[model samples]
Target: MAQVLKRFFDLIVSSGAILLLCLPLFLIALAVRLESSGPALYWSKRVGRRGRIFLMPKFRSMRTDTPVVATHLLEDPDRYLTRLGRQLRRSSLDELPQLYSVLVGDMSLVGPRPALFNQRDLIELRRENGVDQLRPGITGWAQINGRDELPIGEKVAFDVEYLRRRSFTFDLKILFLTAWRVITAHGVSH
Candidate 1:
């Protein structure tokens, strides 16, 4: 019953957001193409539920040739990030495209963020902890709490907590917290 309600809410909200953001997405795509030479959307393989592989779409924010590694692992991740990329990432606009994923049922508006295919350790931990059982999300408890700054262990812990306690009200609170976090520029590291 709750899952039905959550899915219904996901459909309406993600659909509405995608429609509203289409223009901004176009302009951002144009800017990225004008500033750099790569696809406007960057698609990388990500680990989804039950070890399923999916192509996660994000606004192209870094040099196309950047090695597939965690941003934190980069010597100077900022250097590879394009000029517009920084603002998009800082404002969380880079993640807007994932709304499409939600609409398509590959993701939810709130769940555990997907792990990169190359993130063996993170993936392993998530699998061990059953975090991979849930659909990946655009914004999540981990996202609102610590975002990129959180270690994989801490992130999985938060994700586990979310899985256990999630409810319609909890999701609403997380969404509200996400809005506040974005506005205040909290916990965004990169």
Candidate 2:
């Protein structure tokens, strides 16, 4: 019953957000293209619910030659960032394309963030902790707690906590905190 309600809420909210932000989304895509050589959107392969693989779209924030691994793994992440990438990442405008992932069944508005497909350690930890049962999210408890700065183990701990405590009210709280974090660029290391 709760899952049904959550899905309904996700659908309604994502739909409305897309409708309202369409123009901004378009303009951001244009800016990304104008600033870089690659496509405006980058399709990242991510591990979704139950270890499924899905293509998650993000605004292209890095150069075409950037490695496909998580940004933290890069030797010098800053060097790969496009001119507007740092600002986009800090402002989280690069994640705006993920609203479409939410509109589809591939993601939730709130839950554990999807892991990169090559993130074997994180994926294994999430599966072992039963976090894989929940849909991956656009913004999550871990994201609000410590966006890119958290260690993998700590992120899994937060994911497990979210799995245990998930509810509509809790989801709303995570969303609120995410907005605040984005506004302040808190916990964003890169």
Candidate 3:
């Protein structure tokens, strides 16, 4: 019942956000293109529900030559950052394009965030805990608790908890917390 409600809410809210934020999205895309000599959007292979692969889009925050890997795993990831990349990341502007993912059912408004396709350990742990059955989210329990800073094990633990405790209220709280965290740029490293 809650899953159905959550999906419905995700569709409605994501649609509204897309309609309202179209101008901002266009402006951000222009900014990204003007700052770097590459496409404004970066399409990444992300692990989705049940370990499926999906292309997730974000503003091109890193240089064109950046290796396809987790930002945390990069050798001096900051060295690959494009102009205004840090500000985009801190303000969460780079993630605005993912609204299309949520609208298309590739993601939810709240759940465990999708892992990079190469994040085998996290994928296996999530599969073991039945978290893979749920749709990934733009912001989630793990995200609000500790986004880039959480260890894989601890992040999976939070994801498992979310799997068990998920509800409309819980998702609403996560969304609220995500907004606050983004505003404060809390727990975002690199």
Best by lDDT: 2
lDDT of 2 at 109: 96
Indicate the TM-score of model 2: 0.98
Q: Lowest summed lDDT over 10 consecutive residues: which window, candidate 2?
A: 140-149
Clashing pairs in 1: none
Steric overlap count per candidate:
0, 0, 0
What digit string (tens of lDDT, one per residue) describes model 3 on residues 1-190? 8778888999999999999999999998899889889999999999999888999999999999999999999989999997688889989989988999999989998989999999999999999999999999999999989898899999999999999999899999999999999989898887
Please give, for residues 1-190, the per-residue lDDT of candidate 2 as tens digits.
9999999999999999999999999999999999988899999999999999999999999999999999999999999998888889989999988989998999999989999999999999999999999999999989988778899999999999999999999999999999998898898877
Give the candidates in order of lDDT, highest first: 2, 3, 1
Better of 1 and 3 by TM-score: 3
Segments in model 1 whose C-alpha atoms lie over 4 Å from true places? none
Local error of candidate 2 at residue 72 (angstroms): 0.4
Q: Per-prediction TM-score, please? A: 0.96, 0.98, 0.98
Runs of candidate 3 with Cα error greater than 4 angstroms are none
